[model samples]
Target: MWSLFALLLGLVVGSFLNVVIHRIPRKESIAFPPSRCPHCGHPLGPLDLVPVLSYLLLKGRCRYCARPISPRYPLVEALTGGLFLLASRFYPPGVEAFLVFAFLAFLVALSFLDLDTFELPD
Candidate 1:
């Protein structure tokens, strides 16, 4: 049960990390602007932002613009979820586990960002 919760939590965090990976390089406010279709700039609603499920249901296309969404979104989400599930199975919940989770998430964001920009953010 706790592992399932960890997976769900990681999925949600990975979705936000997607935003971070895209926005940090551009120096955009990650929080001020909600998730939007990059092509049409349509704001995403709750259903449009349900982590991997939304991407699959949308058929890898933007709901508003019909542009092909990057496969990376679901990939990151699933990766994070899987990582969290694996960690939960191995580590007892506590500060150390929290640090591990945070470090894993930071690594995920940094890796994707570095792939795009080739420069690490401070």
Candidate 2:
């Protein structure tokens, strides 16, 4: 049950990470504008925002414009979920595991930023 909780929490956090990865590089506010389709600039609806399930259900295309969605979103969510599950399984319930997860999330966000700008954000 704890592992399941961790996985769900990780997925939620991964979704937020996606927002950060995209907005941080562009110097945009992550919270002001809700998530939108990059290709069409269509604001995503609630149904379009489910972690991995929405991607699969939408056939990896934007519902508004039918543009192909990037696979990275679901991939990151799954990866984070897997990592959280692993952390729960391997580490005793405490701050250490939480720190590890936080560090991993930071690394993941940093990697995404690096990929986008080819430079690390300071």
Candidate 3:
């Protein structure tokens, strides 16, 4: 069940990554104003907020307004999931795993933001 645990961990991290992605651009506090749709400002229900499956089920559109969702959601979730698998295989639990996980997360976020905004902030 380690894989399942890893997947669950990845999902939680993916949720935080979504917050980071949304806030980093807007210069807002990630902790403030719980997750909401930018287009309609509706707080996401739990079902509407599942990491990758929700996006797929909704066909990548906000349920409240039907606005097209960005592909970044699944991409980040998949990316983190893959990294978790690879990390578990390559490194036992220790500092290396933590470092690698952190690096992988930062890289994913940086690459995605650069691709979307075409500018580097950090």
Leading candidate by TM-score: 1
lDDT of 3: 0.81
TM-score of each: 0.95, 0.92, 0.85
Per-residue lDDT of model 3, residues 10-90, tens digit only: 776876887888788889998988889888999989998888999999999999999998888887887787777777777
Candidate 2 clashing pairs, residues 3+ apart or interchain: none
Q: 85-114, model 1: which lDDT tens digit per residue?
A: 889988887888778889999999989998
Give the range of the ten consecutive residues with the poorest summed lDDT in model 2.
Answer: 113-122
Candidate 2 lDDT over residue span 6-119, tens digit each: 899889888889999889988999897999999999899989999999999999999999989999999888888888888889877689989988988888888888988989
What is the TM-score of candidate 3? Answer: 0.85
lDDT against the true structure, each candidate: 0.91, 0.89, 0.81
Q: How many residue pairs collide in each prediction?
A: 0, 0, 0
Candidate 3: pairs in clash: none
Which candidate leads the pack in lDDT? Answer: 1
Output the TM-score of candidate 1: 0.95
